[model samples]
Target: MNSMSVWEATANERPKRPVLQGEKTCDVVIVGGGFTGLSVAYHLQQRNVETVVLEKGVVGGGASGRNGGEVLIGYVESMRSLAKKYGRAAARQMFQMSLDSIDLIERIIQEEDIACDFQRNGNLLAAYKPSHLDDLKREQQFLYEAYQFESKIVEKEDLHTELDSSFYHGAFVDERSAIFHPLNYCLGLAKAVERRGGTIYEHSQATKIERVTPDKVIVETHNGRIVAQQVGLFVNAYTTGLHDVIDRAIVPVESIVLATEPLPPALCQQLIKHNRAASDTKRLLYYFRRTADNRMVFGGSGRTASKRDARTLFDKLREGMVTVFPTLKDAKVEYKWSGKVGFTFERIPYIGQLEDGTHFAFGYAGHGAAMSTLLGKLVALNMLNEGDRHNPLDRSRLKPIPFHSQHARAVGIMKYYFKFLDYIS
Candidate 1:
């Protein structure tokens, strides 16, 4: 099987855009042409701003195209933890924004006429341990009491209706959550951006940024330079040497996914009857969902090492899949790939301005599919002075990890800790 992601293999063809040549200028220049950068360009172009997006590779080549495609709600931080850390009101607002982010995706897809298999069949947060069910109950109570959001809890016995696996103790279903073909969504956003006069150049990597004036900066790429009044960095896990502070603040964690060959319709129905995306409660979680074409897309965190053999990773993941669904032991693996995800010490995404006033949003943990799009719009709004009266994420100070160089080691330790917890709990 090829190493390409299933999304790339199945996505519609994207039109090519010219590479940046010589020197050009625009009102705003965005770095990293994934969902975040393209979303920013689309929003800015709506307001008649001359926007340009510079991508290191093709759009969605990064985490955007490689993710599980679950349009989940909330950040990596839980609502209860958010309330405890940053007040109930702040947490409520943040939760509201997450819900709004889901709606925004649907709106964009409909307005742009994107045929990305968008669906709102909802998501299941399965509990791996009995104690984890307690945590889900507490979370459910908080969601109901604080936000009046309703979600159903499925007992272990009834989980068969939602999931075929007997590995889960129970599950919580959030009807508002959704899923879609992420690569097509990225390409659709690019088309919408270009239709609105925003320029997107592929294979044009931004290598350096030189601030010419207080409000103007010049981004130097291999073949061209772009001068803009504002520059926004949305590179996330792929960031390298862009800005010392931003680079140091992010820890790139590798996540790998593998897809099984398409199953029979009856078998697909038996696997996930309702087509809801599902993930378990382990700290090193296992997320799985049914693709539109009836294949099972399963993913999990890879070992903390930067370089890992693809075949070994796929074997481990396949073992995990069999442990969850014994019938899958014989399923033919069709695709295998990995992408780096940006995680911050704070766990929540960061949206702030640099010392020179360049705006940036990154570190989405693993919930970036929806959060990135929302943050991109918010960043554009903040730039236009139309965002919230007080955006906490934009105002927060981002501190790097204490021992940044040992990030991989730290992640390795955390993985072992989680495994231990899974064993004991």
Candidate 2:
């Protein structure tokens, strides 16, 4: 069978609907029906809180569907950075929250019967240069000693047997991480939320948000308006013009991905021997892994700043994949696509409230599949009258993006500069 397009790969396969018509009122209104919005609705509905989720497109239609599907542990950046900024104890708690995200994901899949192809194949973080080996070693040591996590190191000679890539000098395998079908997972969450009696409207573009009072927010869609007691803006890259405050703090960069035709069992064995999700240790990097059916799902950004063309980006990704595994030269690429990833200056995610009764979470820094889900649940918990003083992951510690007005020009330039640095280094 031919590989499915990214849109059809693991779509919910539900009938698309037109915009919502009429006025609606809810305890809480969520914008952007991706992982975050779904999680919020799911958890809030479970708590018997009246909630409605509005999406401009279908569930998982945005980056939620376009991601690489790596269910990784930890935040966007290294835990070392967390320790540097906060204390070691705070960093440990933060790291534990990430680890807990993986567990929560697996539990949701099993308990909710989500058919997302979740697997425990683990993740392999490979180092491209010799200098990176020292960093990998330090990372491994830190994971083991400081974080109480275990990772196995693969030397250059052993890496070929495991990954069949000549570009890396060493690699660290974290057995705690996992991978899954991101779109399927997202759709499953949406369905679970619906099953719990929460309403979800697609093609429902939220154009206006007004603060009716200090505790009441009004969300206006094209066809209807929602008088929500509280509002949650889970929108990421698409936050542009929707929320002026969030748009300034988040930078949207393009992330492209491609999939090759299914390979023979022997060929898969020769390539990624363990069928692990693998990514190089670069800021702007390439991440490739074997699928359940033995296809090479490879992805990397282009030489240009943004992912403009699907065909051209796929061609560049094909070259990168072939460079790593020469045997795939004859293989046909079956799927290709791209999506926007939101990032902030700190490289950490932006999760907090605009003010009282308005919660927000975005800017995952290109790692959103699990983090988004986790943050959404936390947001729901925070909304349900939880004690923020005790919980370390409360919304207070995370700050909003700085210089919020200059985000478009400043973030674009920052992304281009980062891409340039990735090219040179």
lDDT of 1 by residue, 1-425 (tens): 86899999999988887899999999999999998888889999999999999999999999998899999998776799999999998899889988988999999999999999998988899999999998999999999999999999999999998988999999989998889999999999999999999999999999999898977899999999999999988999998698877888899998999999999878888888799878889888899999999899999989534345666777888999989888888899999888999998888888877677778889889889888898999989877978774665664366677889899888888888988988898
Pairs that collide, model 1: none
lDDT of 2 by residue, 1-425 (tens): 23344546646566554577898888999998999889989989998999999898888888888888888877666777678887788788778878888888998999999887788878888887767777778878887789778888889888886887787788988887888888889888988998898889998988988988876888998789888889888888877487666666677777778887778989987898877778987766889877777788887764244445555666777888898888899998878766788877676666666554568878787668778888888889878866244444444444546766666676557657867776666
Candidate 2, poorest ten consecutive residues by summed lDDT: 387-396
Off by over 4 Å in 1: 304-309
- Estimate the overall C-alpha local distance difference test score of candidate 1: 0.89
Model 1 worst lDDT run, 10 consecutive residues:
303-312
User: Residue 375 error for model 2, in Å?
Assistant: 0.7
Error of 2 at 116 (Å): 0.9
Clashes of 2: 0
